[model samples]
Target: MDQSFSGSIRWAGDNSKCLDVQGGSPLVGAHVGLWACRADHPNQQFAWTEGDGRIRWLTYPSLCLTAAAPGLPIQLDLCDSPTAPFDAAAHGTKAICTSEGVCMTVQDTEAALMLMMLGLGSCFLMMTPLSAFWRVTAAADAHDARLGRRLGWEQPGLMLMMLVFLAMVLMDINFCPHLGREQLQLMLMMLGVLVIVMLLMMPLMMLMMFVFHGALGVNGCG
Candidate 1:
């Protein structure tokens, strides 16, 4: 081993626990996760890859944690191959720079990226329905006429919000070097929750409006 560390490998995002194999299995291809660290647990012991960013199991130095593909569960495999693709994406990374080396565990990075991607997709999907609904439906009684029209498509307000969100995401790359993993994780989690709550509230808001109008009539008369 190039460098050995005695402490269990705690997750970069959550330091309360340590990386461990499922069911404490020493076999090849065992799935890994964060588990409560115990001094006697062989599965928790790991060597820090300070030199190559390749985490090695202390009990089995032959096995190194590797991601077989993007979005796949990481597993322990022999590090014997010389031509193995340690590509950041294959390891489920948001990105990989040769200058920086591997940054974090594949699953953790993949999950964070996937969550953001899915949120953006959801926002886009909602835009299509809203645009169509506003166009086909007549609200002649309504006082406001601003439907966010463009050359062809609509929903300017929503599209602007999405653009702003994307800008923040893009800007974060420049901001990452200054922040630690835990702080970055907290920011990601907070942003995720905010977006999710905002989306969910749209339905709740519609429901509340319907209930209010039904109870007191649309014209405020019983």
Candidate 2:
């Protein structure tokens, strides 16, 4: 091994992390994430071809850095062979060139504003159906109370659950925005699971509404 850092492409800072293939896995889909610089790590070695503008993995000469799409994870893929069609997107776009050989670009402020707007829109979309369902339940319970029947707890229970859900959503939006990449990924995973669960429960919610209304109608409480 050469005793110099000529082959290693690392960040400009003295202690900055290097671009590393996650876990040093030799698989085609191995993720490219940042890791602490290790002089001896082959995963941190990459070759940038100025002529073709392709960043190739030195550990696997046949593999090159490939991006499937915008906002997706980068991974190693088979290098574009001569027979393959020329993919103009494989090259980098215009960016703020730095003295450290790092390309910088300012994030679009409109994107952030649109994301915030989408989040608020989703909250309202979710709340609209829930609030309407709870209103129906409240009306049923009110009728039952007038008829000398015991009041059901479903209305209050749903309200409490909704409050807790909103609180969690608010925390996610207002809490620390400087979380580490891994922490942010974990949080997003958990949120995704929560969303899946809510989606799956939609049918069950409909069933509950049908049963509650049916029972109330039979008791002349609707």
Candidate 3:
């Protein structure tokens, strides 16, 4: 059974040391690691095997590797040949293989894209309400009679928040399927915070918009 699989190397940590085989060859005993963007490294080799109806990786015959348990967050092992791939049956179900990688089927890609879209949409929805709030607040602050009716524009804060939101959008777009449990959890946590903040601000933003509109109408007639 001579088979080869190609997929992007996803690192478990900052240093790009450990990589998770999201979908690639089902060779169980293969060793895997990340090489330079274009440089080939021997540590990036991996072997997959099937046993007890589950696929696993083995770097050394004497060593066994284990992935983070399902639903339990843990740092992925970065050390080469640390353990073998976990039982696919234990996780849920194995994904179908494709030419690009193992276990990544057409359905998987579609589903992943849907989830990414939802996340990105939620982030954008959050931003809309906040932007409305800022615009109204700036207008109101500018209208104060003692302040000489100048707009209170805080460009720096607005720029910083915009940058953060843009970054979140990019992250959502480029989310890796082979991400470790901890990294996925962190991403979700940030999204959750943004969702909450957006929800809380929605009503207040609407109220501010109403006030601003009324103010604008009165000023226009004057």
Per-candidate clashes, comma-separated: 0, 0, 17
Candidate 2 at 61: error in angstroms?
Answer: 0.7
Alpha-carbon runs more than 4 Å astray in model 1: 4-6, 49-52, 82-222
Candidate 3 structure quality by residue, lDDT tens digits, 83-151: 324322211112212121222111122222110011112222223211111011111232221211111
Full-model lDDT for every candidate:
0.42, 0.40, 0.29
Highest-lDDT candidate: 1
lDDT of 2 by residue, 57-163 (tens): 77876776664532344567777743211111111111111122222111223221110011122222223222111011121122221211111233233345446
**lDDT of predicted model 2:** 0.40
TM-score of every prediction relative to native: 0.38, 0.34, 0.21
In Å, residue 117's CA in model 2 sits off its true spot by 22
Q: In terms of TM-score, which candidate is stronger, 1 or 3?
A: 1
- Each prediction's RMSD over C-alphas, in Å, is 20.8, 24.3, 22.8
